[model samples]
Target chain A: MLVTCLPDVAKDVGANRILKTRAGHFHHPFGDPSRPEASERRWRLEATKKALEVLTEPVTEPTVFEY
Target chain B: MPTNKKIRVVHYVNQFFAGVGGEEKGDHPLTFREGPVGPGLLLQRLLGAEGEVAGTLFCGDNAYAADPGAEAAALDHIERLAPDLLVAGPAFNAGRYGLACARLCLAVKAGGKTAAVTGMYPENPGVSACRRQVHIVPTGDTAGGMGEALPKIVRLGLKLARGEELGPAQEEGYLPRGVRYNAFAEVPAAQRAVDMVLKKVRGEPFTSEFTFLGFDRVAPPAPLKGLKGKKIAVVTEAGMVPPGNPDRIPGSRASTHHWNKYSFGGRTELPKGSFICIHGGFNTVFVNEDPDRMLALDALKQLEREGVFEKLHEEFLSTCGNGGPVHVMKQVGQAMAKEARAAGVEGVVLPAT
Candidate 1:
């Protein structure tokens, strides 16, 4: 499948917070920013964002093998 | 100058064509008929004009496969030849034949003769089984490759006999002989090593032609059965982090990090509907759903905290499991163990896949 790269799309799907309550579907594969565990949650979101940026390129595929 | 030295070549073959017998030939014990015909003669030619087929040994595949006793006895046949170069098969994709060739080649090699084996095939189980054990020259899946096959084996065999340096396997189109070694050469190995170290000291990385396979050693945790009553702080590849892995541990080969602690009792229940799993490896949710259900944690907690022992040990540990290969697994364990030790925990229990 072809994937499109857009900087704004990643920004929109942005950071998730930790220590969330099972409040609603809105706090999905994401959580609320107010919890005590927010630091871990934000770190995860940033990492995911970086990974997505790496995977989606305009022309070629990303290098898959690592030493 | 004395140029009359001839290196002896030993040939091994299966019973069918050895002329001792046919399908029933596999029972023909190790008997030597000094001759220049049979499969052994083909190998003798490759050993050079100076080489002689000093011995021929025969054994049946059925006998070897069916009885370990017979296979063990067959080792004597190759040992008797004491050849400089040993050759076994272009077995032509035959199953029992392939195994016989493999077994004989291994025996010859173990006896310290330079053994070179050849085989054709899709089902040369012996080629693969003995591959890491000996050099099974690559050949066609059919016997037609014999002309090209045995010649290559002989060339390589002679090279080793002459004590010539061998190159990489694919470059020479030979099988990976799986011989491991260290190299020392005349610029002086010590000087060359110092040169390498100097380059590395200057922030340069050089490649070594040979690399150690991998250090997959994991010393088993001391048996926790003695602490069977303690709340043995348990862990898994379940992606357990401080809520969201602030350390940004790679979902796979995660870096080592400090463990986040959680205290549980009256108010601290990891209740259903309260926890969600972020582990990308396996569906840890199944266990987390009823954390108290997984035996080590629940049963141990019951024994230690409730009635079995004193206060159940401290916090639990965890990490994502999916796709964690050797290196990553080690790093994660190091991190988890560090935290567990800091908490004064006596022992740890880990989930097995």
Candidate 2:
């Protein structure tokens, strides 16, 4: 499983499970400097949790779970 | 002008096919014969009056595998015979024999003086190793398929020897070498694409002009029971590294060695100016301002304290994902997996750029 802003790339490359983070950009998939430090940390925590959640789901094909 | 001269051919076979001994004679040295031997007889008959099996070259499977000079010796014999084509074995599933045939054919093809062709099972290791460098006709897994395989090999060999423009793999009946040749299509690409899209929408069967080679699908491992006490590791291709770029991981096209492990044992967050992103594919300013954006080190540490997981792995694995070749990246991934497993890491979070 991987976290990426470019979910299409991950899906095209055949990643079985992927977490698509809306809050992140290509440069920083987990961080958004625009948000306050606490808010950014909270978003990152949620994103990481979503990535962890993705791993527990059974996937027959490349599937993107949005965060 | 088309010359009337018969297409002179040199045939290659292992000891077993050459009537030398079987596995025992696998160590037999390279030997040359004046005319067709064993399967070469069939190859010659298939060629009829258009080609001649001028000479035969045979070597032990082990001999070829053990002898680094085997290819040079074969080339010398081929040069002396001056054959227009070199037809190696329909080696089938014989690993060593298949490898030898593919390698010798690759050498002959590289010489440019003679065209070369061989046959092997599609799954033969040799096929993957040298398919792009040589022409390999697909055969069955064993010699039982020779009757069906030889005719195709002979046909392809003759065309290659005559310097003919061959068609695509499906049409030519050879393995796809992954090299694209430019050819005029009946319709423009834009029209073809539209037709394909319409066909797809209409649920009609249509063959796509271009086929994408897909990566092998790996079955996902069963997920960890829970993160409560599991040791999770953070891995990234974000190119985050300590100041000064200690390992000199390239900004792109990073090979296996470029991947490195770094210790973030006690750090709550990656402080500014302490770590930097060297990835060439994206602007690094945002990540450089706060490295945690790329690695999530701070969040992971906080989670660790909150009992989200037992403890964060002391070290995080990293490499620049920007433009890394697929093959090298595969090796890097394997190496990182091995490392994580050895360290008893239960789960990994790999954030990619």
Candidate 3:
């Protein structure tokens, strides 16, 4: 499984389980420099949880789980 | 080359095509005949006066599989026969037969004496095994396609024997070998670009000069039963490494050896200034400010503390994905998987940049 800002790229490459992060940009897929340190950490933790959640779901093809 | 010269051809076939018994005769040993046999007769007819099937070699699929020296033996016979061309089976979709045909053709080509060719279904396992190495004309899924397949095989085989330059896959009626050749185009590049753009704007069909090959689809492994007691690892193409970049992994187009594993033992987070991002594809400032942003090491450690999984693997694997070639990246992925599996890692979180 993988987390990427470009879910279409993941799908194109046939990644079976993907988490599409609501990232600020390619530079910071998991971090929001605009946000305060604590809030950014919280957001990162939530993203990680979503990524882990993607692993437990059954998938017949490349399926993206939005976070 | 003299037009009157007769091209000597050696035809290869499996037991079924050789009139040997089916299934049971699959264990039949290597055998040779003086003249065209079965499909070779059609091949010779197609060759007409330009070529002759000097010999036909037959082997059982099971025999080929059972003997490691099967290909060597065939090569020895082919060498002694000294045919200008070796035409292996239009094997269609028969897996074992297709593989034997493909492998033998590849060996024949590598011998640098006989030009070799084969035919099979586009989706045959043999196509993948040797398409890039040998001329494999695509055929129908079964022997029902033999009529159409043989003409193409003969055409390609004859051209190869005469040392003629082959056209593109589409024009030559063979599988794409994933090779590019330089050619003089009738149109200039700038005009062609404009023409393509105009066609797109007009919504007319226009073929692109380049074709992107389709990626191989891998079936998803079974989902983990649960994450509670699982041992997970963090991996990334975000190129996070120690501040000094000890391994000297390049900023772009990193090779297989550029990938490395760094231990996060006893560390709850990747401290700022201690690690940095080296990927050249994107801005690394944010990740450099806090390396945990790229690897999620801090969040993963928090999850570890919460028993989300039994433990976070001690080492995290990383490589610079920027401009890395697909072949090199594949090797890097395999190497990382090997290391992670050896460390008893059950799951991996790969954050891509």
Candidate 4:
């Protein structure tokens, strides 16, 4: 599973596995309806796609998403 | 039963608070002095004739944090003082000083002769790390709040020293440590609920009976080898339930401790008509259109078909993540992990909303 969160959070939590997304911790970030409809969709799809990529990568230690 | 003896109190502070040089003196070692110094003077005055400051303990924040032996040496000094109560900090926003105070409290308690108490900003890392183990009052973020904070800290310390029965954190003005026990209330639950509801309706502030303590950080386990044949499962805290909402988990502000489990044992994908999102924290429209928006069961099924993994754990653990208490969430997660391990599930993809 990919944890989509900020690098600071990844470090603060000291979690070895994370997909370091550029967002704050909490809730379905991409599911927020406050943003423009198209942008919201783009963010959701992009995050999900990134998570899938993270799922396939191999690493010996704690890894962060390149994106 | 009134004893004529005055209660002995020990006050602890950092070098800066003790009238020593600021950041530069932080490397200085621990020092012991007779009677109060700096803020301790105010605390001593607050104690009045009922209690006396037997000694003041001072250490540089850097010294305390840097020296691994500081805790033992400090405790040795405090134990020799033989004070009935230990008072540390009112540290305000100083993170290092706050942690120093917290560590001193723990060390004092370990000495076993006196009760220890301290105060710091609720947001202090010290508070998060040590709150569960000691009695800490919630103070303001800056030293400016000291006037208000010291009195509370001293008062609470006095109560503890005198062996007075203490009230809950809310009533006593300290940070809650997730401790709960049975006690009678002045009003019935129905009446209290109505009173709280009325206050909410009037837009007046009211405190809830149950408070949410923050979450704990769980470190990730070592990376697993090859996913080609590992058993994986997907879970969600987005309130996905079978179409009829069988478990009835609340859509938002769900029960702080309840987590429900659903089994999809042999299903290739979550059928379009079989599930729905009921999470009240956000708009559910996107998830309703495709339940996969939350857990991505269909995608997982596709990956499974493509042989990404040998098996998918059919059972899914779930809860409404939006507003669950941290302590309860930890317990639920622990239980879920234990069950997954027993079921031979190798990994989990937890999608949170």
Q: Highest DockQ among the candidates is held by which one?
A: 3
Off by more than 4 A, model 4? A1-48, A52-67, B1-4, B215-353
The sequence of per-residue lDDT tens digits that candidate 1 reaches over residues A4-66 is: 122222122221111111211111222223434445344333332322222222222122211
Off by over 4 Å in 3: B1-4, B14-16, B19-38, B54-67, B94-100, B201-203, B241-248, B255-258, B273-275
Candidate 4 C-alpha lDDT tens digits along B123-212: 887887678878899988987888898888878887877778889898898899878878999999999999999999999999889776
Question: Which residue runs does candidate 2 get wrong by more than 4 Å?
Answer: A1-67, B1-3, B19-34, B58-67, B93-96, B217-269, B273-275, B278-285, B296-350
Q: What value does the lDDT take at residue B11 in candidate 2?
A: 96
C-alpha RMSD values across all candidates: 15.5, 5.4, 3.2, 10.7
lDDT of 1 by residue, B1-353 (tens): 12345767666677766776778566666556675447566777666686788776666778767777665665665566666666677676787778877877776677765645555463466665576676666777766777878787777766655556777765665665555656565687677778888988998987554533333322233333433333345554545444445655455654555234444443233444333345565445553553432213334444454443444455556565556654445666667777777766654434322
Give the alpha carbon lDDT tens digit for every residue of B1-353 in model 2: 15466899999999899998889999999999999999999999999998999999999999999998877898899989999999999999999999999889888888889999999998787886678788899999999999999999999998989988899987999998877888898999999999999999999999877755345567778777877778888888888888899999999999889989988857888888768888998789888988888888888887888887887898999998889867678789889999999999988888898
For model 1, the stretches where C-alpha displacement exceeds 4 angstroms are A1-67, B1-5, B177-353
Q: What TM-score does chain B of candidate 3 reach?
A: 0.82
Ten residues in a row with the worst lDDT in model 4 chain B? Answer: B214-223
Better of 2 and 4 by DockQ: 2
| Model 3: per-residue Cα lDDT over A1-67, one tens digit each | 8888888988987889998888545776777778899999999999998888888889999999988
Residue A9, candidate 4: Cα error in Å is 17
* Model 2: DockQ vs. true structure: 0.60
Docking quality of model 3: it rates as high
DockQ of each two-chain model? 0.04, 0.60, 0.83, 0.15
